[model samples]
Target: MATRTASCSCGQLRIEVNGEPLGVGVCHCLSCQQRTGSVFAALAAFRTPYTVTGEAREYLRTGDQGGRFLFRFCPVCGTNLFHTEEDVGDRSVAVAVGGFADPSFPPPEASVYDCRRHGWVVLPADVTVYDKDPE
Candidate 1:
C-alpha cells in the first residue's frame, strides 16, 4: 500500500492515508473557489482508516444541491485541509491536494462545475468535464 501524508501549511494538522485515493477531482463551484481562495479546489478522496494528527476548526456549509459539507481547517494557520459530507457515515474523506505538496501527485480525473470555471484556465484533454455535479 502506498501511503501519502498531507498537512497544513503550519504543520499543525496532518492526515495520513494508507493507499491511493479512490478519486481525484477538481471543483470549480463558487463555494469551492471562495473556500480555497483559488480558481478551483483540487481534492483527493480516500477510503476510511486514515489517520489525523492535531486539532482542527470546522465550518459547515450547504452546497448548491443542498448537501451539507463539513470543512476542517488548521486552527493555527487557517489552511483548509479536508472535508466530508455531514450526516454521512465515515466511508471516505476528501483532502486538499495542495496539502500534499507533492509534484508527483496524480492529476485530477474530473472537473466539476465547469460552468463556473475561469475562461482562461485549461485542463488536460484527458480530464472528464461536467457542467455541474455528475449524478
Candidate 2:
C-alpha cells in the first residue's frame, strides 16, 4: 500500500492516495477538454479515504453519459485538478495525473471517449482504445 501525493499548480489543493489506482486512462471527450483546457484529460482512479489538503474550487457538470460529476480545481491557480462523484461516496476520488509532483506517473492504461478525440491526437497501438470505458 504505497501512498502517493498530489498537488495543484499553486499548491493550494493537495491530495494523497494510499494504494494503487483502481484504473487509469485518458479521456478525449469534449467536455473533458473544455474543462481541463487541454486536448485530453488523464486521471488515476483511487479508492476512498485518501488524505487531501488545501482549498479547492468545484463545479457540477453533466457527463457525456448523462451522469452528474463534480470537477475540482485549485482556487488560487484555477487548475482543473481532480474529479469526484456522489455515487462513489466520500471514500474515493480521482486524481488528475498532471497534479502529481512526479512526472513519471504510469502511462494511461486506456484511452476513453475516443469518438471525440482530436484529429491530430495519436496513441500507441498497444494501449487499449475505447469509444468510452468498455465497462
Candidate 3:
C-alpha cells in the first residue's frame, strides 16, 4: 500500500494516510469557496487509520441543509486541512487535496455544486458533474 502524506501551508499540521480513498470529489459550493478562498475545493475521503499530528483548530458549521460539518485548520497558518461529514460516522474523514502538494495525487471523480462554480471555470470531460450535490 502506498502511504500519502500531507501538511498545512505552514507545515504545522501533518497527516499521513495509507490505502485507497473511499471517494474523491470537487465542490464549488459557496462555503467551499469561502473556506478555501478559491474557485472550489477538492478532497479525498478515507476510512480510519489516518494519522494527524500537530496542533489543529477545529470549527463546526451548519450546512446548507441544516447538517453540520467539522473543519480542521492549522492554528499557525490558518490553512484548512481536513473535515468530517456529520453522518459519515466517526471513522471517516476527508482531507484537503491541495495539502498534499502533489501534482499527481488524483483528480476529482465528481464535480459538485456546479451551480455555484464560476462561469469561466472549465472541467475535464470525463469527470462527473453535479449541478447541486448529485442527489
Candidate 4:
C-alpha cells in the first residue's frame, strides 16, 4: 500500500497515512467557507494508524447538521488541517485535500451542502451532489 503525506501551510503540522483514504468529499456549507476562506472544502478521511507530528489547535463548532465537529489547525499559520464529524466516529479524521499540496490528489466523490454552493462554482458530472449532508 502506498502512503500519503499532508501538512499545514507553515509546515508546522504534518501527518502520514498509509494506503487510500476511506472516503473523499467536498462541502459547501457556510462554516466550511469561513474556515477555508474558500467557497468549499475538500477532504480525505483516514482512520487510526496514521502518524501525526507537530502542534495544532482545536476548534470545536456546531456543524451544518447540528452536530458538533472539531477542526484542527496550525497555530502559527492558522491552516485548517483536518476535522472530525461526530457522525463519522472518533476513529476517523478528515484532512483537507489541499493540505497534501497535490493537484492530482483524488477528486471529490461526493459533494454536500450544495445549496450553499456558489452560482459560479462548477463540479464534474461524475461527482454526486447533495442539497445537504445526506447522512
Clashes of each: 0, 3, 0, 0
Highest TM-score: give the candidate number: 1
lDDT of 4 by residue, 29-130 (tens): 998999899999999998767787999899999865588898989999999998777765768788899999999888889999999999999998899999
Q: What is the C-alpha lDDT of each candidate?
A: 0.95, 0.84, 0.89, 0.89
Off by over 4 Å in 4: 86-88
Candidate 2, residues 55-113: lDDT per residue as tens digits? Answer: 87789987655666788888899988787876657766889998886777887889999
lDDT by residue (tens digit), candidate 3, 9-42 = 9998998888878888999999999999999999
Against the hidden reference, what TM-scores do the models get?
0.97, 0.91, 0.94, 0.93
Candidate number achieving the greatest lDDT relative to the actual structure: 1
Judge candidate 3 at residue 19 and give its lDDT: 82
Taking the tens digit of each residue's C-alpha lDDT, what string does model 1 give over 9-128?
Answer: 999999998788999999999999999999999999999988999999999999888888999999999999999987676999999999999999999999999999999999988999
Quote the lDDT for 18 in model 4: 81
Q: Model 3 TM-score?
A: 0.94
How far is each candidate from the true structure, as Cα RMSD in Å? 0.8, 1.5, 1.2, 1.3
Return the lDDT, model 4, position 29.
91
